[model samples]
Target: MPEGPSKTAEYVATFRAVESARPEGERLFSDPYAASFLDGKLRLGAALARNGMGQRLVCRYIDRNWPGSRPSAVIRTRLIDDAVTAAIEGGAEQLAILGAGYDTRGLRLPAAREIPVFELDQPPTQERKKQRLRARDGDLPSNVTYVPFDLLDEGVGAPLERAGFRTGLKSVYIWEGVLSYLTPEAVDQTLAWITASGAPGSRLVYTYVDVALLKQGGEDEPPWSSQVAKVGEPFRYGLDPAKMDAFLGDRGLKPVWDQSTLEAIAQHAVPGGRNAPGFYRVAEAEVLPDR
Candidate 1:
């Protein structure tokens, strides 16, 4: 079957846009270009509007239980924000976003203005996102770059390297909402490449669903997950938190933060409502042994 645009991509764009549009006091994080990217997708926009009820439910649940729960969308935004901030602080000259499907961070984040941001994705998806941004008059940050390639293909790393990514310079790598779409082997291979290619102190921020969650199949499934399953790209990979930490530790990387930590940050940022349970876990690791 020919691979067409995944509905999951559209859903993600909508979710981000909704969260971005929230008022300052109520918002967990912001993505200025999210709404722009979904400009023509009336169905998606409508779906997102309808999902507002679910978001409210999630917010209430988080408020009661977690007290300071950070929705997954907020968690992801903060993770990327931290990664970008850390890269800039550590003097990283480049930033790479893997599987950057319709993501607006490259254009929306102010830190991107100084550090070169490279977005790597398939040609078709990248083209579609580029067109959407252009139509929206979204201003691509001056330092942002786009690399089109299939990460699953052999020699996938070459394009990134050619796009000004170096082996010995501080860098930040983000792979949000991506690993679950890939097979286990591919996930490991991608990690290995990042570990091998990145400079000391480089950081990577990524999210993966828990395998146990997938097996149990509870009411916790995000509304978009079932719809995304209709397409061939159901979530497939889950990282055992303990094993994931050890795996990266062996590669000279140390897990510095996780979902719980972000949840705390969110509590402080947007203190009241029920936040969404983290159906997905986000972690940040640095490319050096723990102190």
Candidate 2:
């Protein structure tokens, strides 16, 4: 068997494996396609499992604290699920996953099969993902499409639009685990493009970390924040819930949901305690016409 693909592809392939390994765990996210996509990527699977152990530990902690609700992992899963639901409810016929990597929603979700699912990523990332999926005999749903382009390039939007995505129809844009890798300017530009390119009722679900956590001058903070920074993926953009509202408001987006760690834990039944120190944040909003 060919040795999997690029780093990004391998990373995602492993994520699928870990997600699959959780027994009766499919109910957590129910991604049956994960295992198949991970075949032949044993190293990736092992790596993902190693990383996921920490996450699972956190989830277990959250569960001990916030019983009777979904765990933090489930909460994160629902965040994405709700965004997809909102898009469908808003009459969106298309869904675009930016920095798609090895996302399996196009393969696992029935609704995704009904609506066109576009996976956007760099050429190498996209090519490698396709190779892995093909190797596993993974069948992409008929509605799935792949668009390759660098998000930083000015021409990014053109290729997407040319590949059957239109500004006139409602769409859902998912940017999971992506914005942290970008600069503030790039983040703004990406949002601007989505606002300009999506029709009314379209929505965006993206994640980011608090900027205060990124700054060294901040008061007592979690060790994980600094640790993540040392890993070279420091959180660059932090949004004051209010500031985020205003920022998106100016861009014609209506903030529908903003979740803090505690709030997400409560809402999703995550088990970690407040002592665990939350570092990641997720938000969802809709593109509305100028008021």
Candidate 3:
């Protein structure tokens, strides 16, 4: 995608870097390694965000252009972090992150580090991620495995298995910030694959945009959509949050919880701050035992 690492992944990492730059008490999650994945203007922006004034300036610019992107990423990161930790405590034996671009969970989460963590993404992005990790930490964590494959070209099963992913173990899969760029068929295939490959109690956490917005945008595309399209990645799939239960159920998944960006912002963000767009959301579901 885009001839190299995904630009959107860097953007999400930049958001995390800026959030991590916040004072210890004010930050959602501490991802000290986020800044290591950024470069150029993104790198400078993250550096400037270390202080309150600069943080506001950087965040304001982002909010003005992308609305809820920064806060959504920040809040979703924490949400998924909690879900992953809970999964491990609930007996997850392995963690698989599909489309895992620049995500530092395996390295930052103590619970995740205790078990095998599979990071799967397109080859270019995965390679860049490895290079960045090696450069920043001198060596990648022994617990994390990187699997590279084209998301649009192939199913994740073979690549992941080749990378040491084992089925029949209760697992947690994180497919964050990736659904919108894939076709609906790909999305359905992935959900079904997870059910077929993970144990009965496995969990899958993912983020998606609302289908209404995707279908109703009509002639006027949203700024966020156009911005991402300009960089080669475009929004392609969405699901109605109201139908999440049925949507997951048909694929052998039981919905656990669905949280909108607005909900995440209200629950976790500082009050009177920029509001995250409600249409973007995160949801988690567990693999249903075969009937």
Better of 1 and 2 by lDDT: 1
Residues forming the 10-long window of minimal summed lDDT in candidate 1: 61-70
Task: Residues 182-285, candidate 1: write the lDDT tens digits.
Answer: 87676777777787787778889887776765775568655445644666677766777768778787667888777743454555454342345444677888
Ranking by TM-score: 3, 1, 2
Q: List runs of model 1 lying over 4 Å from the truth.
A: 39-70, 138-141, 217-225, 260-275, 289-291
RMSD of 2: 5.7
Q: What is the lDDT of candidate 2?
A: 0.64
The per-model lDDT (C-alpha) reads 0.67, 0.64, 0.88
Question: Which run of 10 residues does model 2 get worst, by summed lDDT?
Answer: 1-10
Per-candidate TM equals 0.81, 0.77, 0.96
lDDT of 2 by residue, 22-107 (tens): 55633345555445444444444333444557548534543453332123334555568767876776688888999887677776
* Winning model by TM-score: 3
TM-score for predicted model 2 compared with the true structure: 0.77
lDDT of predicted model 1: 0.67
Total clashes in model 2, counting residue pairs 3 or more apart in sequence or in different chains = 10
lDDT accuracy of residue 268 in candidate 2: 43
Q: For all candidates, what are the clash counts?
A: 3, 10, 0
